[model samples]
Target: MSKSESAVLDTRESKELKTPTDLARKGVVEIAEELKHLLADTFVLYIKTKNFHWHMSGPHFRDYHLLLDEHADQIFEITDEIAERARKIGETTLHSIADIAHFQRLKDNSEAFVAPKDMLSELHSDNMQLVKFMRETHEITSKHNDVATTSLLENWIDQAERRAWFLFETLRAH
Candidate 1:
C-alpha cells in the first residue's frame, strides 16, 4: 500500500470504539484522559507504597510494614477499575509501563532508606494528592453527566481519603 493509504487505514483503525453512554464524544474523551492520568498516578503510588512496605524498619517495624502493605493493596485494587472504566467509556486503556510513566503525576522514590515517619508523611501527602486528582476528575464526570464513572470515583475518593487519614493519624502518633 502507498504511505497515504496506510495512514488512512491507521486512522480508521485507531478511532475510538462506540460505547453506550449519554455523554458526548468530547466529554467521553476528556473523562477517559483524566482516568488515564489517575490510573498512572495510582500505579506510581502503589509501587512507592510497596517499596516502603518492603523497606520498613525500626521499633514499630511490623506495624508500619503491615500498614503499608494494606495501603498498597488498596491502591493496586483501583487500577483495574480505572482502566476498565476508560474502556467502558469508548477509549483505549493504557497498554504498557511506558504509558503509565508518561501519564503519571506522582514522583517515584529511589532513596536508599527513608525514616519510618518520613515514609508515612510522604504517603499521606501522595494520598491527599490522589484525592485531589479524583475530585477534579469527579467534577469532569459530573459535568458530563457520566453518573457511573462519577459513582465509581466517589467510592475511590472515599478510599483515598481514608488512606490519607490513616497515614495522618499514624504520623501524629509518632
Candidate 2:
C-alpha cells in the first residue's frame, strides 16, 4: 500500500467507529435481559390471546374472537421485533416453553377456557408488564444514544399501554 493510504487506514482505525449496537453495548445488554423477559411474557401472552380468540364463547364470541385475534397478531409481530432486536445486539432470546415459563410474567392456561372478563384481565396485566419493561429499555437506549431502538421501544410501549388500557376499559364496561 502507498504511504498515504496506510496513513488514512491508521487514522480510521484510531477513530472509534460506533454503530447503534456498539454504542448500546451496556444498554443493549440490559435491554437484552429485559427482552428475554419480554420475549417470554409476550410469547406466552400471545398464545393465551390466540387461545381466547379461538375458543372464546358467549354472546360476544364473534366480537371477542376477532378482537383477541387482532391483539394476538400484534403481539406476535412485537415478538419478532423483540427477537430481532436481541439478535442485533448479539443476544440469544428465550427459545422454549420451559424457558418462557421460567421468565414470563404471563402463565399458560391449558386445562379450561376462561371467562371473557378473566381473559381480558390476564391480557391487561401482561400488557402492563410489557409496558413497564419497554419503558425501562427506552431509558437505557436513550442513555446509550440509540435513537432508532429508543424510538422503536417508545412505539412498542405506547402500543402495549394502549392495549392494556383498552382491555382494562373492556373489563370495567363488562
Candidate 3:
C-alpha cells in the first residue's frame, strides 16, 4: 500500500471512532488497561523467552530450549490477541519496546546470563501475573456483559496458568 493511502485510512478510522465510542460495558476500561499492560508484559516476556531459548545451557539444554521456544511463540500470540482487543475497544495498540517498557509491569533482563532455573522462574512469574490479570479482566468483562472478551480471557488465563505450572513442576522435579 502507498504511504498516503495508509495515512488516509488511519485518519478515516480514527475519525469514525471519534464519535462517542462504546465504553466496553461494565468498566471495560479497567479491563482494557489491564490487557494493555498485560500485552506489554507479554512482549517483554516473549523477547526474554527467545533469549533464554538461544542461550540455554546445561544437561537439559535440548528440552529447555524447545520448551522456551514454544513458550515464546505462545506469549507472542497472546500479545497479538491483546493488541487486537485494544483495537476493538477503540484504543490504539502500543508499538515498540520503548512504549512497552514505559508502561509494562514486567521486568527487563539487561545484561545477565540467566540460568535455566532462573529462566523457568521468570516465565513462571510472568505467566502467573498474566493469569491473575486476565482473571480480573474476565471478571470485569463478565460484569459488563461482554461474553466474547470474557471467554477469550478465561481461555488465556487457563493456558498461561497451565504453562506456568508445567515450568514450575519441571524445575521442582530436577
Candidate 4:
C-alpha cells in the first residue's frame, strides 16, 4: 500500500468503533476504558522496575538489579498485549507517553538515591497495586464477556504476584 493510503487507513481505523471482532459495544467500551488504566499502570511500573534495576545498590546489588531487570522485562512484555486487546475490540490503544502518564495510578520515584531495601519495598508495593488493577480488569473483562482479555489478565496477575512475592521475601529481615 502507498504511504498516504496507509496513513489514511490508519486514520479510518482509529475512528472506527466497529469491526468483525466486535463485542457488545457498551461492554467493549467499558472494558477498553479499564484496560487503558491497566495499561497505564503497567507502563509506569515497567519504568519504575527498570529504574530500580539501574539505581540499585548495597549488599545484594547484583541480585536486586537482576531481579528488577527481569521483572521489568516481564512487565514491559504485557503492555503490548493490553494495548492490542483494546484495538482488537475497536478501541484506540494508548497513543503516547503522556497518555500513560495521565492514566497511570502508580507513583514514580525520581530520587537520586534509594536504599536497596527501600527500592525493593517500593517496587513490591507498586507491583501489588498492579495486581489489584489486574484483578479489577479481570472482573471488567469477565463482565463484558471478553474471555480473551480475561484470560490475559489472569496471566498478568500471576506474573505480578510472583514479582511481589520475590520482593516480599527479599525484604524479609534475616
lDDT of 2 by residue, 114-165 (tens): 8887888888988897788778778876777767778888888888888898
Please provide, for model 3 over 1-174, each residue's C-alpha lDDT reduced to its tens digit, 9 standing for 90 to 100: 999678658868777642123564435566667677778878888887888889899999999989888888877887778887767765666777677987788787764678889888988888888787777778777777767678888878888888898899989987
Supply every candidate's count of residue pairs whose N, Cα or C atoms clash at under 3 angstroms.
0, 0, 0, 0
Please write out the lDDT profile of model 4 over residues 18-108, one tens digit for every residue. 4435589899889989989999999999988899899887878888888899999999999999988998887887899999888999998
Error of model 3, residue 169, in angstroms: 1.6
Off by over 4 Å in 4: 1-18
Q: Whole-model Cα lDDT per candidate? A: 0.92, 0.78, 0.78, 0.88
Better of 2 and 3 by TM-score: 3
Candidate 2 lDDT at 67 equals 79
Candidate 1 local lDDT, 1-174, one digit each (tens): 999777657767877465556679999999999999999999999999999999999999999999999999999999999999997887887989999999999999999999999999999999999999999999999999999999999999999999999999998888
TM-score of each: 0.89, 0.79, 0.82, 0.89
Off by over 4 Å in 2: 1-20
What TM value does model 4 have? Answer: 0.89
- Where does the lowest 10-residue lDDT sum fall in candidate 3? 17-26
Instruction: Output the lDDT of residue 108, model 2.
Output: 80
